[model samples]
Target: MTTTPMPVLEELSAAEALRLMAGVPVGRVVFTEGALPAIRPVHFVLDDGGIVFRIVGAQRLADGLHNTVVAFQTDEYQADRGDGWTVTATGHATRITDQDEIARLARQLPLPWSDRGHMFRIEPELVTGRRLTR
Candidate 1:
């Protein structure tokens, strides 16, 4: 019997990681809630090397994220070919309170969610990624 070869894992550069991140629309945001770790899936867009997303007002996740260090991750997999990549960005997230800026992002990103949600931008301080290939 012939054996299948193992997939190769490769590290991606910061620019490449961001490029890959921009290709996906949904990602997970990790933060703290009630002194414990909490993660939520969010629809996001990559802009100027930062991750931008939305959350409804007065949410525990939103309240905890402002000016806070958090991790955002996104990945894609192809099971038939055994190839995929995952990118994680760690940074401080800031709520977009500027009406003009929020308006611009609203015009640009057009997130498929409630319009009343607040906008947040995560300026990635550390970005890392790995790719698996057959």
Candidate 2:
């Protein structure tokens, strides 16, 4: 069988990054537990110039809620040539517990791909990304 060629890889600008983020609904949240790092896929929304999502029964994730400094990323990948685009945003996350805040954000974010949702908010301090086109 013949294989397809890979697309060119390019760096995405800040504007492009934000635009790309606006289109996607899921991303990975990276955090550290003791010495090891963990990443989990989460459905999120871009609101108030930040990221917000709900978590159900994530104990480890609940621990990370202590601080806002975290790494959130979204990307696309292909196995054939291992080509894709990934955008990583380094920022702090805040657990929104206030009833008013939750209600407001809830109105803005419908629901994630999961049945039970735990809401969390993240504000990016630095954003960097690369795109690989085939």
Candidate 3:
């Protein structure tokens, strides 16, 4: 009888986790809506040790997330090799209202959707990551 090898799980340092997060463009933002948990997939950029993303016509979501604790997660998996890594950042999210900052971020991170939207930044207080290796 053949036996399959067990996968090993490794914890990543904050710096390495952040580095991995920077390599990905899309992640999930977890927040609360109507006192219930909700998650949205968004295109994001790692900037100055923070996560920046935009939302369009989502006033309720923006209001709910602004100045509130949230979680941002991104992961990459290689099914063929059965190895992958996932990173999660938890922090308080704040809306960006400055015109110049908004313009600069728009230039730096281009989103796939329309330009009209609100921008938010989440300065992570806790960053955790794990890698699964075969």
Candidate 4:
């Protein structure tokens, strides 16, 4: 008997992925804790090649929401060809401490979610993506 191995996702073009992610309004934010990984869906935006969002007292935020590298991904799927694409942005997150900068960023990117969420930013070092092109 022969066995087949699962194929890993091949990387997509950064530009294409960014375009898709920019158009989307939400994504999954992934992080690590001890030997386990945790992920949560979040509303986000892309600005100046970075990801930004607000979270309201979530455990993920309480655990560690600053200066840590995390992965952010967004994707969409259709019935045909199982057509879909995903973009992952790996970056460091930090609380926006500067009032002026916060105000500026706020104007460009408003927080559409609840008011309880605090402003956080992720500056991505490497952004890659993949899509099912049939």
TM-score of each: 0.91, 0.80, 0.93, 0.79
Question: Ten consecutive residues with minimal summed lDDT in candidate 3?
Answer: 108-117
Flag regions of model 4 displaced more than 4 Å.
1-10, 33-35, 58-63, 108-111
lDDT of 4: 0.76
Better of 1 and 4 by lDDT: 1
As a whole number from 0 to 100, the lDDT of residue 110 in candidate 3 is: 59
- Candidate 3, residues 1-134, lDDT tens digits: the string is 86767999999999999999999888999988898898888888888988998876568878878999999999999988889999999999999999888888877775454256789999999999999998
Which tens-of-lDDT digit does each residue in 1-134 have in candidate 1?
Answer: 97878889999999999999988878998988779998888788787877888876477667788999999999999988879999999999999989888777776665455266878999999999999997
Task: Write down the RMSD of all candidates, one decimal each.
Answer: 1.7, 2.9, 1.5, 4.6
Rank list by TM-score? 3, 1, 2, 4
The superposed Cα distance between candidate 2 and the true structure at residue 76, in angstroms, equals 2.0
Q: Which residue pairs in model 4 clash with each other?
A: 12-129
Candidate 1, superposed: residue stretches over 4 Å from native: none
Candidate topping lDDT: 3
Per-model C-alpha lDDT, please?
A: 0.86, 0.77, 0.88, 0.76
**Clashing residue pairs, backbone N/CA/C < 3 A, model 2:** 6-134, 7-133, 7-134, 54-118, 54-119, 55-118, 68-92, 68-93
